[model samples]
Target: MKNALSRGLLLSTAIVGSLSLYSLTTKVAVVTADADNAGLKLPAGFGALVVAETGARARHLAVTPQGNIYVKLNRPNKEGKGILVLHEGPTGKATITGGFGSYGGTGVYANAGYLYATSDEEVFRYKLNSKGEVTNPTQPEKIVTGLINRHQHESKSITLDKEGNIYVNIGAYSNSCQVKDRQKGSLGMPNCPILDSAGGIWQFRADKLNQTYGTGTRYATGLRNVVGLDWNSQTNQLYVMQHGRDQLHDIFPELYDTKQSAELPAECLYALKKGDNAGWPYMYYDNTQHKRMMAPEYGGDGKKVSPGNYIEPAAAYPAHTAPNALLFYTGTMFPEKYRNGAFIAFHGSWNRAPEPQKGYYVVFQPFKDGKPSGDWEVFADNFAGSSEKVATGRADHKPCGLAQGADGSLYVSDDKKGTIYRIVYNKK
Candidate 1:
């Protein structure tokens, strides 16, 4: 009786409101993951399965309301295609249905009857039909172009809000805006010219076309780089994860040891406002001290505190974790504990040498009343395949992108292997 009731619920309503018990049998439901869970360590009652494997460098992803998957490749495939569309099959695997666009970087998003994507230097959008298929697969309107991409930390991740505005990340070209970037004993350039065109987030009209880099409003400044950002509808605000600058010890040996360099500046989660300044190049958030500290490139010892009243991070995580994706959980599939919280996919680190490189997994941060509620905890792990691999900085799969399906399942993409893993909550 328990098995029968669980397998078939009538869910009666206005004839079209909910599914009849028999109607669900024909649906393309996601099957349960294997006993091994495809090599992921998720929380209890959660399971994950391999969805699809694109042979390109899948960076970020978007899923349409109808469950179609759009994956952005970091580089164009041999066929010069950048966006790969996949359709879920009956047995829970995904099939590549089609692809579009010719250039690539990061930032693929589906919203408001269009599919938006980005290259390192431009943003494009394609019209979509009611069925969620791209009407113009090859001919996308160039929304914004000529963005500053100096090839250092230059992936243009993007997100959109309800107000018809699109936000883009233009990463800094220099590690610390130094006169001789990353060189020992180098001083920061006056005023950090990089902040003018790069090192910040910009807001632009989502519907406009052919807009150049100068046309967009500089939404916020002083961020070195942000790969994962999301517009939190629950809070009606924008949030971003900034990648802290690197090589502190190599540049200022007297001020920092290698272990300190690897773990000094914290990867920050910033709840942003229109004119917010996060104080990059000039300062970094030291998680251990939980205070903003002056950067060594700007002539400060490690202990000097920043004087400016810049915005402090909403939350902080370990440095060099390389947070690559941020998603505010608004879906209903997970338990109430996850509602309105944030899930960040850390791509892991290469610079945490002598300290055991870490962070090839996903983490969950609780939220309450539009602010972070408590400490973050590791929600998923073992993408490195073993403890030995993470200790040696050899992660087999680096989770890069995240998307939520119509059914509220979470999809994570791996850039290293281009594997997409779909995580679902199922308990017997």
Candidate 2:
């Protein structure tokens, strides 16, 4: 009888020892980083690693608390998969384990035990099991449908507020709401017909099924395009980064020189309220002038002040930078200054011809009392790979999406080469 008891005790001890070894191995792998910081230039004490090479047009991504990463591709792969699932292994790098969702779009969000994703004209949700694995990837419930997709600015970017509401951006098809749409010397369409269905944000129930435009409420208007948005828990408000219109000098050479065109209308960050209008077709925020100037197509030249009724931007950045993702930090891993502040990923600029194209990096905007406090600073750079590449407007990787890990690490996605980078601060 004594020998039997001794044998059982030894078996239990062996099992416990094996588990300890496994746990230690996983901890070491999770904290490790690539030696070169994955060719990214981050702030002091911050390092980066290549999470995975998804090999698709990874537009946006969501990281589960369990470390599972879901990346949304801009288009479906040859296998008809638009979502790639990455699971980090004992090697400190993530491996593409699975993929699902046969359609493509630009947005992906994980909240309330569900994975919400968007196509060009629809939003869908899939239930995630306790392990953060999507249980019904092959059959997702449609939350929204019949959205406008003009093939230009057609990506439907989405975000969810805590109150079970989702907001989707429907971009205006017209460059400046001109009657002829990007044609030089064309006047702006009177009252802008696109405003009735596009060029705005619509709010709908996050959990609802098959909700269309008739069921949703137009939450905001006059936004030319918005690809990045997040719900600010610090202020209980929705914040969005707007991509300002293009072709200032090309269409209106008499009013704007190439230098002015390169730097005229600033990409804007807006804190939204219901019915807020940011004045797209009529006006644009000028960071240099610190004022909203009436759009040339509408009636006034570049110098004319805009109407006071138009909602002003909370902050503005260099024009044509193409702000693609907005994330408000709420983690303690970074310094106290980063808490509740915002990170914006600029996907580089193409409209700054004759001058060097700029802004293929991430910027940190400080926040005080739930509003922007001081000047924004570059947080991560060199995604373009070289200064010559930035000068020639040829970026190797454009930062398009931002996500925060369970450990407060920041993740940025590049659609060009389908690379995912994870940024961590002050690692041991």
Candidate 3:
């Protein structure tokens, strides 16, 4: 009947390589709450909850050093994976302690004690312990893997740098490279040899987990997409945001105007180093003359500009609110004006079509001594449940990943509902 140690643990591949079924047995504290939901709102000492809701498409999050909370879900409807842990208490309650996915696009991180994860091509690591859990999640290793998923900007998103290196964005499956991507003459990719292998951001060597995209190193390039990235230990550099690039009226319909393609390019933010370039297709970033223009496929069209190069943007927004995630608040809960500031998450915008849909939530910006000092707030709103409906940039909840905890609180992720908020600063 199938049970002799489950058929010798499935024909014994050395008992499945000596079994380590992604260890997970956490539950030291429990406290569920969901009297309907619709919560969150901070400052005034701060607080917001709902640590784990449906639990299936939660996106990014990493915390550990014994505060537990790993998240990274997004398999949805066909589900089967791991990494969801949780486990936090000291009164703020949270506990799931079971989940460890890897093998395809979700992005979870944990650093130092090692946990790392990813999958729209590959990256993995596991062997955490000393309370952060996962002592050997089914033995993952593969640090990199063929990463080139042509599914609309693909999802890689990774971070780490303090000398350990390991940045990974790789987006650009065609859009401004057009030539058929957005259709028209479908002509584009002029000098875009796919930027030496997909748009930008590569760097590797976080202990070399299993590297393979030809090994790594191409630290920066014309980036037409970067679902937000981080590493700003007070200016150690390497920040990113860029998502700009969309059909501005189906590629220069005689020079924009669908209401100026909802607002015209701009939606950048950069800091990169080590060979930086930051100009895609040709150049964009012109939030009312902030500068760097010329990008109607390389020819001066929307008011000229761009000549001899690019690289400029420490700020600029309003376009397709799609900035996925970026963090940099050294924690301590909040106030001190939010320490190193820089939240960001915005999974909102359906082209701003004629004027309506705009970024669904999260936004902070306030870096002080390392740059960007103030201007830009709205840290978490109703996540598009309805702020007067324009619907179809869609979102019953769409904030898309950002994490930090180990007392510094704040962990939001919502690949369209599968929630996992947690804000906190309770100071009661």
Candidate 4:
């Protein structure tokens, strides 16, 4: 009887040992695969690799110090989980290690040993272990909840500052905050009620758990919808890319022609402070005019200028580009030209139909003294698969999020193809 018991214990130990051995072997075999860079075009010194064919609608991503990549999906995977954790093998290849979190979201950021993510209606966080992986997948602390999600521009993008504060973007549901939203010639609301709880960035405590909307402070207001935002540590300021109001011609064809509608309102990048207002619903910045113009909903004829003392954008880009992600590069892997600059991922535009669709690439804006110094130029291109595909709005991949790894490599996430591309500068 004693021998039988000993034999059973020995068999159990062997099973455990074999499982561990298999895990170790698998990790070792995860070498970096050669990513096809044929489709992506870049500058002379930079190259990209398709690290992982994630097969999930990847939105935003966070890279840990230990080199683990955490991706937030716009929708849940087969197991109903929205977060995917990836580990890089010795050969620089990344493989999915685990999946967690139930509700899909558009924001994922890591700071102070915690991985912060947001669903459309709430913000949640998971504690990270020494290896940069989540310690508890099934349980996460709900940092903020009860956010309004009205389906139109409902993505809750997030950013974290060095001072332990988290900023969340609660996009306005209506395009122009019109009286009868989106209706032709609909008058603008004098005082947009959505500004009370939405259409702004809310600041919350990074360490606090289970807080609600009332607990957060409206950091900045009058932003129509901001999907691309980041904290520039160098300037110690918050920066955001505001998606300008759409349908200028459709709403007021008398004031604006189709060509003007496709190109009048410029996508803007604003460097924000605590009480800053970008002047939405009331005014829209026209890069061509070089001034903030009053919207047609506000009784403007496309040539009327705004009277409000609104702040101007740090830099402005072409209209309908749909800038989706912003990152201020602080890494040393790239040349001096790229360091301290801002990288913007344009998710491409659908409204520029009569005209050719544009902005399916990543752009670099040079900065000096914490402000834009030179013209913003395309850093990476050809994500639309081809110029013909771009013109017809049939893009193969759209760059949605940008992240920097510990080794100074840049990572871009595509929601359309569920792919992650890593850009590295091999000039040296």
Q: Candidate 2 residues 1-428, lDDT tens each?
A: 00011112222434222222223222243355578888988878787889898877899999876678999999999989999999865443789998999999999999979999999999999998877899999999999999999998898999999999999999988899998988888989889899999998999999999999999999999999999999999899999999999988989999999999998789999999999999989998889889988889888788899875888899999999999999999865677899999999999999898889999999999999999999999999999999999878788899999998765678999998899998876532
RMSD in Å for all candidates: 3.3, 6.9, 17.9, 9.2
lDDT of 3 by residue, 167-214 (tens): 889888886886677875455667877778778889888777567667
What does the lDDT read for residue 292 in candidate 2? 86
Candidate 3: Cα lDDT at 103: 48
Choose the strongest candidate by TM-score. Answer: 1
Model 2 residue 301 lDDT score: 89
Kindly provide the TM-score of model 2 when superposed on the true structure, using C-alpha atoms: 0.93
Each model's TM-score, in the order given? 0.94, 0.93, 0.37, 0.91
* Cα lDDT of model 1 by residue, 232-297, tens digit: 998899999999988889899999999899897999999999999999899999999999999998
- What is the lDDT for 317 in model 4? 96
Candidate 3 lowest-lDDT run of ten: 1-10
Instruction: Tell me the TM-score of model 3.
Output: 0.37
Q: Residue 198 of candidate 4: its Cα lDDT?
A: 86
Distance (Å) between predicted and true CA of 204, model 3?
Answer: 0.7
